[model samples]
Each structure stands twice: as C-alpha cells, then as structure tokens.
Target: MPRRVAMILALLLCSGCSSELRNIELQRVAKDWSLVIRASQIIPVYPLTEDLQPGDTFLVQRPIDKQHELYDERGFLPLENLIHRVNPRGYQAFYENSLGLGGDAQPIPKRWLTNQQPWTQAPIASFPTYSFSVRSGSGFSLALPVQGVPIGLSLLGSDAAQGTITIADARTYGVDTVSLAKDVEDWAAQQRGFLRNYASTGAHPNYLRVVSRVYLAGRLNVSLQSSDSSGATASGGAPKPVELVTTAGGPGPQDASLEAYKSNLAKLNELIEKSLEKTPTGSGQALLPGGTVKVVAASARAISLVETFSRPLVVGYLGFDMLIGPGGTLGPPIPTYAVLTAQLEPHPATVALELLDTAGLRHTYEVLTKLGRRGDTRAADLVKQLDGLGTLVPRQYPCNMFHFGDAAGPLSIQHPAGTALPDQKGFVRITLYLGKLQSSIDDLERAQADKSLKIATFDTRDAAVDAYLAGELAASRTALRDMYRSLQAHGDLLAQAQEHATQATRKLLLE
Candidate 1:
C-alpha cells in the first residue's frame, strides 16, 4: 500500500518530468447539470482543437453569477496555456453533463458560453464574497487561486483516467483552510506515516478540487419524473418511488420550484395531518397534475414525499465524474479526499450579508446572540435598536414540502417503505435529529398558539414583533447551540470515515 501511494505520488509529482500516462479525461465540475469533458485521453499537444491562447476570448467553459448563467467561471483555468495541446475537441467542446432539464440540452456554443447571462440582471458580485469552509467544496474555486490552483483537483486528469467520486466529504467542516497551505501543514500533523509525507502525497492533491467545486458540492442524482398514472417506468416501483437523499446536499432546493411539490405534498400531508396529525396513509399516493405523488410511510413529524413525473423526464444521467488515478485504475480516490475535506475560509464580512440572505440566519443571529450573552450595558439611546435585533425574517417561501434531490441508488426501487436516500447520511443522526427538531418546532407552535388569546394589542399573534425582540435575541443562543452541535457531529463523522477508509484499504490490500 505504501509503495502504491508512493508510485502514484511520484508519477504526479514529476510536473515537468515526463512519465508515460495512460488515457486521461478532462472534466468540468459545477453544482447543477452543466458541461463536462467525457472520457478521453489527456494528450499534451499545443493547439489541440482551437487556438485559444490566453486572453483570446477562449470560452474555457464554466459558470459565474453576475450575468453568468450559473455562477461558474472557468477563465481562471488556462488549460491552453498549461499544455501545448492534445485532443482539443474534448477540452474546447463542452457537452451537456446533465440529463438535460430546465436549461439547454445541447453543447453550449462558443458564443453562448462567451456571452452567458446571469440568472438575474447586474453582476451579483455579492455571491463571490463569501469565504468557504471545507464542508463541501462551496467556495473551493476561490480558495484555489491562493494556492495558485475547483479546484482542478476537480477536473481533467485530476483523476487521470480516474473516474472515482464518493463525494469525498471528509466530514470535517470545522477547520477553515483559507490558507490551504496552512491546512496542509495542519492536516500533515494528523495523517499517519505514508500520507504524512506531504513531500510526495500525489503533488499534495491535484486540481480536480476545482472541477468538483463545479460538478459536485454534495449529494447525488436528482431525477425529475411525473406520473398522472403508475406506468412511469416498467419496474412498477414500490409504493413511494421517490425517497429522499436527505443527507449530503444542502437543505434541499429553496426556491419557487419546491412550491410545485407543495400541492402534491399537501394531498399526502393532509392525510397525515388529518389523522390527528400522527397518521400515516398506509403508504398513500396522491394523483396530482403531471404526476403521482406519494409520501414514504413514516411518522407524521418525519414526512418525506416523492413525485414521479407522469413521463420519465430524465434530463441526463449524471453520467459520472470519473477520476482515473495513476496506473490507470480505480480504488477509493486518495489525495483529493484530504483536499475535499479542507476548504479555504472566506472573510466573514464578505459572507455575512450573503449568508444572511440566501443561506443562513446564523449570521444575523450571531450578533443578537453575542449581545444577549455579553449583557452589555450600552448607553440608553440604543435600547430601541437592540430590542428589535432578534426579529430574524428567514427567506419566506415554502414553509413545508421539500425536494431532497432524488433517491440515490440503482433506481431506488420503490420507496413503498422509506428505503433509500444516500449511502452515507451525514452524522447518521441528522435524519433522526430532524424529528427532534420537528418536535421542538411543534412545541413552539403550540405554546405560541395557546398564548395567542392574551395579546390583544397587536392582531398578529403576540403584539407587534418588536415586543419580542428581547425574547428572540435570547433564542439565538439556542439556535447557535443547535448549529454548533450539528456541525461538530459532522466533523466527528468525517474523522471516523477517514479512519475507516484507512482500515478498509489495509484490509483490501491484505486480502
């Protein structure tokens, strides 16, 4: 095993040194279904397909927000400059990596890519501001330049012919590797003998880390299908076909698209809600427009629904993010695993506003919680501003009904039983924890409902919201506590996974 690790490192480390390399593939990584270089040989011949010299308006093909179609920008990666050339078509010609959906289903034209527009008008520079932690590769692209590096450990030969992707979620989302070099030093301390030798740890992780930022941040496989009736597929799936990969990815998609599921989820939710709110519909299905929606039978508080589109609406198979390592083979992807876990931390000032906007209430909550904790005796004039500090208005939209990507697996055969989600649900307890959280939510709602009658000053529940700022401010502490505990748990899980991988690899070698 040690010898093999060394061999892999030696082959990749010889940057200017030539060693025979097998057929290699280049890939583009992003969140949604974007473009990628399919399996191909990575030949280093100049001017492969197009003469896209640096600054020659080369559509390197990636995304970025602010008039950019998908917040992806690939110009920073100068493949043309790096290698003289090889087969240029694969590099220059980007193909639909996803099972074509809402967007286009063709190879993005050079013009289309060069003139990509943002989802909204005006460059939303606000996005690029946030510094990312290594929870998943969120701001990894930004993190790369510091190291002069999706960290391409994300694309191209970051895999060689090496197509391997387990999402490499190292579980440790705590330590921010803003100065990933420092992160390497720190990680070096924790690593065992063979890997500790950063001097030869496969060039200390290659560039795929960049492409992964583009292709995968977390989780897998979101399939969209509808069913006005059953025969959606020949399999005649189990009761609730769409089980949720409730782990890995973000807290699911948060936008208008989710509202489409609400009505259908409502049909099922009503059944559960109606049965005194503790009911299960005996694995019921709601025949709604465009599809047959069903709730995987579970207790009322822990609801997950799936909508099978009437027709098989597969935009594209995720195809795959193949990363062939040295010697043109496959195994648990090494080197990059550490790279994936560690992320560069962004400036708080940069991210605080953005996080507060689309992502987290934690940023806003932090200020209030701090004030509440310190119990600062400020000058009297500021008391009014302090009082309303706790009224955090979360992005209000679908209060319920979420689409947890798609059930990940060999077509998660019918969730007639709440069967599949992801191979590894973060912390194992995240799903269970949701139930406890729901209980807390239920308790809060009940308490608020009971107290509704006493407050007559303001019609909306308990007086004007300003009246509860102090109380809300105090609540931030609890909210922060939950977020902290959750993050900590994920960190611990990552450690365990790392150790487990080591042991398993050793076992495999022995066998």
Candidate 2:
C-alpha cells in the first residue's frame, strides 16, 4: 500500500451554520533530519514599523529625514568611507580647588564616538571614567599617558575671593555652560547628535564645543581655565585661581571639615563604608556602549528589516552590523544592546525541525524528508539544500524566489523578484574602530575622585597610539601635542584613529 498522508482540519465559526472545517493534509515521507541556524546581529531600522505609537515605541518608528543627502553634503562613498575612519570615546572629569566644590562633571559623550573599528580588538565599554580634582591659586597642570591619545582639558571652577568665575573659550569648553550641570547635559546632547549624524556617515560638523561654568570660591568653587590662542606662558594667558582638593571618593565616602575630625576618626570610618556601597562602580559593571546604528538608505532598511524578523532559525537571511568577539574565558563582551544583537539565541531552524510532524505545514515537512533520504553519503548535497539553494522551484516557475547566505554580508532573498530589494552597487558594511574596553573596572573605581584626570589619562594614551598609527612622526611629538589639548578636545583624535584602524581591518573581510 502507498504511504498515507497526515491531515489537519482548520475551522472557522460563524453565527448561523455549524462551523465548516477545511481538512488540509500532507504526505508522510520515509526519512527525517534536523536543521540548525546561526546569525550574529540584526539592527532594526524605521522602515519595519508599519504603524507608529507614542513615546519610546513611537520614537522607534519615527521617520528620520533622508535630507542630509550624504552624497551632496559629503559625496556618498567618501562620507560613507569616513564613517569607518572615526573611533570615538568619552571620559568625564571631576576636580576641586581650594574652594571645595563637590559634584560629578562629565564630558559630552556624543554618539559619534560609539562606532567600533574593524581593527579594534574588542567592543567599546559603555562605562564612564571616574576621576578627582584639586584647584589652587597657581593651578597644577599634570598630564598622564592615556592608552596614548592627545587629550585636551577644560576646568570648571569658582574662586572664593571672586564673586563669580567666567569661562571665555566656548570651543574647548562647549557652547552651553549656562549652569555647572549644563555642561553634563549639553555633553549628552552632543553625544546623541554624534550617534544620529556624524558617526553613521561622514557628515563632520564644523565644531564640537565644551560646556563650562565658574563657581565662587568657598565651600565648593569650581571654574574652567581659558586656553591662549598664541600658546604662551601659563600666567601670560593664565586666569587667576583658588584653593584646591582632589581625590577619588573612598568607601563610605563622606565629606567633612578638619573640625569634624577634631576628636574621633571612628565615626568617619563608618560613614566612608556606607558611601562605598553607593558609588557608581560599587556593582562592578560598566555602562553599555553608547551609539546609534543608522540605516540611511532604502536598501539598508530592507536588509535590516528582513534579517530582524528571520532571526534565530533564519541565520542565512540576515545582515549583521556588529559582533562582539568571544572572550578568553569570560564569554562574549557584554553587548552594547542585547535586543539589537544578531547572536543566535534559541536556534530557530533546529526548533522548527524538532516540530516537523507537529507543525502541520506541508512545505516544511517536505523539506525535512527530502534531504534525509540519501543518508550520510549525500550530506553535502543536503547541506547545500539547507544552506545555499539558489534555485529549487519547478520548471513551470522558472524565475521564482531564491535565497543566499553571506556570513560577511546580509542574508537576502532575490527574485527574478528584484524590485523590492536594495541596490547592491554601493553596498558596504562600515565598521568603526573602537579599542577594546579596559580589562578591569577596579582602577576606574579607585580613581573616581579624579574623574577628569583619569579619563584624560586614557585619552592621552589611546590618542598617542592612534597618532603614531596615523603617521604623525614622533611619539613624543604626539604626546606633546596631546599635552596641550584636553580629553574634552579629543573628538578629532578618536575620528582619526577610527579611520586608520578601519583601513587595516578591511583586509580581514570574509570572502
């Protein structure tokens, strides 16, 4: 007897007659095999949203203007090309003068600084750098090695003798220093712009200014120092200063005057212990990498949309933007955004095969059995069927849909069905250069008081290596140039480093 078929009766109910059932059936095949899938990351773009909501969900689908005319503003390919060139990172600076100002001050952590260079050894760490500060009449200026990047500085201060402090240079000290806290806020705003504008493509803004302020010296006065255009003596261009104190806050960190410590140091110890638990680094995790993944063109949008929906089970049909390299023993680096990743979570194909008989889908059932019939000897053919089946439909439908997987590109479907797909001519995946995040967080926690100092140190070192790679001649030349600049002025350094790293890494692109 011939093999029997399995049937599924799907029913629809109505008001009058008894519900009619459509009995759908599929033939039973002799052999069976399972399937598996893997994909790296699928960043979604706005084209996927058919409808818009309010709030975060609405913002997710909100249409971004295509007006930037990347090709016009910066020729299409060059702007696209420059994106891979910039590797941006941000560091926060916290300092104090004899006046005793206490609070946190972060640089503008703009989005442009988020891209990871193809050559960057590891993904960017999302955490902020913590530091301490000390200010006096003749302020101290000390520069340290940052992974060797040339970093500039901006000081937020207030003098006790002077009623109010003033910050004159908006270029180094951003434009919006209306308030002490404004610096932090404006910095964040700039970061968002970098993510949305410059980093995605090569649309470089004219300038990135620092936000700054001046506090009157007393309990906690702080102010920004102005840089001289001529690059002369400290006093020739120097602004008058005030008192100072700088420290990375300690466990159970608490502020007290000498008078508070006149008698017992025991109470001070307990207070310090309490503060440790509340410090930013107390939990031992860093901030998530901050940046945006933009899909500028229609083709980029379609690719991202398809891959996102086909995730887990549909590895062959994705366009992954980034992948965190596996760690030595600690697992993969913590991804900047989990939901936006392409890493296979629950393999979809394998799951679908496990439910072959239970799925009640004829096409799925047929695919499973056909590849299993010839056993192990024909495994290669089966693998091709499971993976690169460019054309499998019957002669009657000669120009039907075809599927192809690209471990290096996007998994895509094409038709003799081409209109809906994006133009592949200018297609390229631009990966930014961001060095691996620091290996440990212990140092960051310890240097919390000198927030600006520590960040500046890292920027100086990172930029130095970047400058050397960019062919800036001497290492000392790069270091000296960085000495005069502050971490607050490192936008160009990060961008240049990214450019070099991307060029070096492109040689490793998958075939």
Candidate 3:
C-alpha cells in the first residue's frame, strides 16, 4: 500500500513538470508573435538612385524621337552626341580622381564602370599641351597664343610673393602686331604695349586689359631673376622649378577661333539635318554620319553650350515604344525613364524604389504570405492573385517573348494569355514595385527576430504572456496599415498592366 502511494506521487510530479513545459512553450510563442507584429510596423524600403520630389523638371532623352523631320526639327541642335563624347572623358577623369588613381589607370571598382558596350580606350589626341613657371616677385605675366589667337591668359597658379599676371588683348591695346619670335623679345614688346597704354590712358578699360593680383602674407627682399621666355633660368644651376601644365582644345575638334568653330558646327548640323530629311520618314533608319560623326557633333555642341551659357546639359540614351491607336482610345506609357536629370523639390507623395536583383522580390512575397497567415485577409487575397498578375506581350523588332520580374521568379507576373502581347511599360513598373515589396518583407522578419530576443528575458510566464499580447495589439494596427498600402500599390500595378495590354493590342491592330 505504501509503494502504491509512492508511485501515485511520482506520477503527480511528472504531470506537474509537463504542465510547466507546456506553459513555457506557450509564452515563447506569444512573445514571438508580438515581436513580429512590432517589426511589421517598420519595413525597410529600397532607395532611389536619384531621389525626386513633385514639381521637379528633369531632362530626359529617349530613342523615341521620331525619325521624321516634322517631329525631329528643333531651333537648337540637340547636343546628345557631343555630350556623349565629352562626358566620357570628364567622367573618366572625375572617377579617377575620386578613386585616387592617376593618369589613365583603371579604377579599383571596375564593376561600376562596366556597361553593355565596351568602353573606348583611346586617349584624347588633339588638344595642345602647355607649361609655365613664375619667378619670385610682386607679380608675373605670361601669354600663350593658339592658332594666332590668345585664347586664355590667367594668374591661376601664381604665388603672392611672385606678384600677379596681367593679360592685354593685343588688338584692343593698339598693338596690332604680335611677334612670333622665340625669345624674351616678344614678352618685352607686350610689356612696352602695356606701358604705352598706361601712359596714354590714366586707367585701363575692360576691353583693353585683364589683370589679377595676390598679396603676400609677409614682405621679402627679392629681385627679379633673369630668365628665358620659357620661364627657365639661363644659368641652369638651380633646381628645376615646378611648371604648371595646361592643355587646350579639350576633347573635341580644334579650330582657329571659338566663333569660327561654332559657325562650322552650325553648318555641319544643317547639312546632317538636310541629309536626314532626304531619307524616307518612319523607316526607323535615320542616317547617322560616318567616321565618329556623332562624337564630333556631340563634342561641338557640348563645348559651345558650356562656353556660351556655363550650364551643363546632361544627356543619356533611352529605349521604349511609341504606340498609336486607331480611335485614339489607347493609353500611353508613363512619360518617365529610369534615368532622369531634375531640379528636385520636396514632396512627400513622391517616392522611388529599386530592386536590383531577383532574390529581393522572393523574400518580399514570403513576408507578405506570413503576414497574410497572421490574420491579414487583404494580404491573403492579394497573395493568391499575384501569380496571374501580368500577360505576355509580343515585340516586333526582335520577335521574342518578354517576361516581367522573371529574374525575380515565383512572385513575378506570369503571362496570362499566350496570344496576348506583354505590356512592356506595365512589366517594368510592376517589376519595380515587386522588388520594393520584397525588400520591406525581408526587413519585417529581421525586426521580429530582434524583438523576440528582448521579450525572451521575462522571468514569469504570466509576464511574458502579457507582453506578447500587448505586442500583438500594436503589431496588428501596423499590419493593417501595411496591408492597405500593399493593396494600393498592387492595384496600381494591375491597372497599369491592363492599360499596357490594351495599348499593345491596339498597336498590333493598327500595324
């Protein structure tokens, strides 16, 4: 009887232990659920390459520019080609400087420089090279002539102790003749002209002279050392002084004068336009000039624009379709491109998101599914319909099927009808949103994990349970808001997709 009583006691103890374990499990689950809810409140969204706000005006260049003269004509020549040629050189230099690489060395981060087409590796060939030096004095002066014209004169690298540099437009200064002599004689003649002008007029006028000066911090007893015209000492005993080297002609074709160069460019453009006019319109075959034609035209335009206006004109290449409908009932794709140059202003409603790869989208869909299972009915319904989102659209040029977000699979819109042409615009826009959603979902899961650890420290089961329940309530509110936002974004994507499909069908019929 005593042994039987002991066995009963043992059984009772085991049962109590089992109950405690079950309670602990329940508390853990509650805490985890609460953490997940809190995490859902803040989802990390992808940032845009160029952040934009409302009322921003950005310059966009697209291949959609019609080949027809009626649609292509403009008062000012498009500097697209010139910008392309010159910008690459400037970009190379800027990037090299940024990476601390010197003199045509490749950057360490080569991936950033890689593009669909191989980059041209040739160096700039036509610019004139120059070198100069200054002696220790109150000021100094130098003049460089290119093609018989003094294009630039400055005191850019002069030292205060070495004085300043003065420039006199020889023609305006009543000095009609500039000696091409290779010695200090030419410099002496310039100095005499300056003296004669000063003696004749009490003050120099803007058209006559341009002078720059820098004051020294401390006075020094020094005399002007005799040197050759090259700013090098005749004695040749002193250490070689640092020389300031500059190049003229920039990255494009050279001319005797900027004005002449501009005139030549205008003529060239007129000729090209005339040639294009002769071609059959709407043939999709606009005649581009041969032998670096685009490069020459682009460089000329870019140089002229910058020199004349001092404002940069940004340009880029874009590819998209222009669809026309029979009754004009068809909707056009959003008149926006992936690349934009805009003057931005603050607008809370404007947001841009990018998903560079596929994995990001899949992760987003998984998170949405989790949220759906956790009592988000809207999310649940949307998730169910995601698979049937987009229809395949046919392309005319290359003649192949195009899929949206296929790179980021499963969550991507599967082409609904085999006969239907994919809406390229819808495909691109929806793909972008899918990437954004995926990124946010991934963030939610990470946040939940972090919160779970904090809730785990509760010593009492009742305390854990209370915290978990409180977390759930807070999370539920946020989840509901997120669900609505997701639905809205998805709805827009669907609407655009339908519009794109309709446009495609109309375009095919018209064709």
Candidate 4:
C-alpha cells in the first residue's frame, strides 16, 4: 500500500512574491534624533505586549565581525547576534507626542495604533523582546531574548535626500538574513551590483539572489542617512526631514466575469465543505523534539489516489521525495497524485509519483492486465501471490518529509495500512485501474499535452470492495464514479481559490 506524499521545506501559503509599501516612516522624531526605526506610536509593536513599551527603537545589525553569506541566513540565529534595542530616551519624544509621560507603561489597545500590519519584518520572523533597563532606566531597551534574527539590510539613496536615515519592517525568506557591514556604506553596498539590477529590472525574477552567497529573497529595502568620516552616523542631533510615500488603489477595467467567478467560488467552497464533512479525518504524530512541520506548496488535484490501509507505515523509509514531479519531460496533465496535496480538504488519503506515476504505475498495471487475461487467468493468481508475500508486496511504503526545522526531521505524516479483505480484490482492482491510467499518462507525456485531465482514480479503498465482493458491478461502478467526482470536487477547490486570487489581482494592479 504505497501512500501519496507531499513535501514542503518552509512556511505555508507563500504563493510567489510581490513588492509592498511599508507604512513605517523613519526619522519622525522630536528629541535626540538619530533617525532610528522604532516601534510606531500609531501601531502596536510586533508580538504586541505591555512590558515591551511602544516607541522601542529597532537597532538591526549583524555581529561586529560576520560578513553576509549563505551560511549566515540560518533562521535560528539568536536575536542577540543581531540587534533589537530601545534607547535610554526611546519613548521620551513619543510620550510627549502622545497623552503620556516618560517611562509610564501604556498598553497599545484602542488608544494606540490598531491598523493592519503596517510593515513587513524582513529576514526576521516577529519574535518577543523582553524589556530591561540600565543606567537607572535612561537607556531602557527591549532585548531580543530569543526567536528572531536580522539578515543584512538594504540601502536606497536619492540625490535629493541625504543626512536622513530610516528603516521599515518587512519579511524576506520568512527567516533570518545576516550581512555584517563595517558601516552604512558597507551595508548598502553588500549587494550593490545585484540590488541595483533589482531596482532597474523591477523584478525579483528568482526566489533567491546570491549576493556573496547571502540568499536575498524579497521585500528588503533600508535607507541610509549621511555618514561621518568613520562611515557611521552621529548618535545625537536634530534628525533631518523624513521621506514620504502614499498608498493608493489603481483603477482597473470592470471585470464582471471575475466578480461572478468569485461569487460562484464562494458557493463552491460551501459545497466542498459539506462534501468533505463526510470524509474521515486523519493525523500523524510527529517524532519527539520536533512536531509536524507546516505545508506551503500549492497543489492542483482534489481527489486522493493512494489506497488507505489499517497497517501503520513510516512514509519515506527510502529517501526524501519532492512534491512537484518532472516538467515537460513527464508531459502535460500533472499526475493526479502530484496535484493532490495535503493542504486539500479531507486530505485524501497525498507527490510526485515519478517512477510511480510516469513509469512504474503504468508498467505495473500493463503487466498485471496482460497476465490476468493471458488465458491462463494467472493475473489474479500472480497478484494474490505478490500480495501473499506479506510485507514484501507492501500494502504500504515508507517515505520521507521535506526537512527544514530543528525538530525530528523524520516525522511521518501518514497512518499505517488498516485491515484488508482476504480476497485482495481492492489491490487487484487498483492494479487494473493503474494499468489503464499508465497508458493515458504515457500518451499525455508523449504528446506533451497542455491540459490536465482524469478519467479513472487509482485509489485502492478497501472498504469499497464490499460492493464488488457482493457481485454488484453497478454498485461498484457507482462507488468508483462517486469517488472520482469527490476527488474532482475537492481538487477543483485549489483551482477556485487560485482563480479568485488571479482575478482579484487584476484589481490590485494600478491601471
């Protein structure tokens, strides 16, 4: 019983990248203005808390010695490795600006910034910083106790604005970025050649840009003020005027069809929800130390193709397999199992079935059908003999998960095979279906088909065989068709969402 597997190495829902405007306006200061990017008085601090006061200065920098490189992008890099500190007089100006006093604790609720995420926390996942003070509370600062890292910073300069610095929050790589610059000049120049190309091209074409081996991802833009002889800015002075950028929605031609599509999609989701409600739910225990990781890859199929078994199994007893299979080489019409992801509802009981999908599945079925009809009627006996070989024939196969976390990297996401009928009819039927499916898949691969389609499901659901066992071909046929329909119903779910999003994006574009 080979189970389908989907693998992801990082966070979920990262559907490509796009540039976004940060709300953070730097240098909006009154006293002792060094033009720092502090927590905003208009909005609560990330990981919003009381002890960690508002207006906490965000001092982002790498260690005194490290340089930007791929090795430095590790997300688990300690917060202390980077810098997150508030000044001694961090909130002095903010207090007077607001209806408050110096050092008086003010929790950010309605009285504070309660807007959407104003800025992205690039290269850094939002982590809690504990509050502490020194020098009798003058240099009170928020200390990064754990769970965040600062990658390198980007510098954008204009001939118009100098001697004015700023920093905005953003997320890139959904992990840490560490580029240690000796000074501001050094930082902005970390990837100057590539960064310049980034702005000129206005397209971050790839998921990564290798700058001195530091994998720069998306949404990273930091500004620099005037620097001194030492290539650093003075800590004290009247901060220069900060730059401003406004957010606006661009106009688009009316797309009533897209709007209608959205409305229909909403209804489809409702229908899917009701249908999925009848499917059994399943979960796998993550190995100790690290729990199950989240899935991020977007898949296309709704129905499951793997047969469920009562027997337990550890997927990837072999090696880590990827979710996305071969490209045009495998041909058009992605494998149904490949399109069927864990993220889908009623997670059909989920990868790239490379040899399994493209070669093995087809060949296995072809040989089986040929044998079964070889006049010797040896097909049934051959399959029974294989199935009879105990675990060697394998009702279930072991597989690996895509690993990235510190936890036990080998956590299995599938349940073991359950009870099976003595007759092996379910297994026999699956081979025949797979045999038929292999030809279609091969034909598509050879044609390099542009569209995906499914005619038969290879899911070996043992319970359904009860209908066949009772000599009810019509009932079995109906059951098979229902499963296929269910698979389509579920699989179309991803399509509906992608369609709605794609169309809605037409609105986001500034006409």
> TM-score of every model?
0.16, 0.15, 0.18, 0.19
lDDT of 3: 0.26
Worst lDDT window (10 residues) for model 2?
25-34
Higher-scoring candidate on TM-score, 1 or 3: 3
Q: After the best TM-score superposition of candidate 3, give how far the Cα of residue 191 lies from its true spot, in angstroms.
A: 58
**Candidate rank order under TM-score:** 4, 3, 1, 2
1-511 per-residue lDDT for model 2 (tens digits): 0111000000001111222211110000000000101111221111112111100000111111221232122211111111211111222222223212223332221221232321121112111121222122122221111100000111112111111111111111111112322322222222333333322122211111111211110011122232232221111111112111223335553534443333223342233223222323456633322111111111100111000111011001111111111110001111212312323331111112111111122223233334335352333343333232212211221221222233221212233322232221110100000000010111222233232332321344355534432331122222222221222133233233333334433533643
What is the C-alpha lDDT profile of model 1 across 308-339, one tens digit per residue? 32222111111111121221111111222222
TM-score of 2: 0.15
Q: What TM-score does candidate 3 reach?
A: 0.18
Cα RMSD (Å) between model 3 and the true structure?
37.5
Backbone clashes, candidate 4: 36
Model 1 residue 293 distance off true place after TM-score fit, in angstroms: 7.5
| Candidate 4 weakest ten by summed lDDT | 146-155
Q: Residue 363 of model 4: what lDDT?
A: 51
Question: All models: lDDT?
Answer: 0.24, 0.20, 0.26, 0.23
Pick out the ten consecutive residues of candidate 3 with the lowest summed lDDT: 168-177
Point out where model 1 deviates above 4 Å.
Answer: 1-178, 189-232, 235-265, 268-511
Order the candidate numbers by lDDT, best to worst: 3, 1, 4, 2
What clash count does candidate 2 reach? Answer: 85
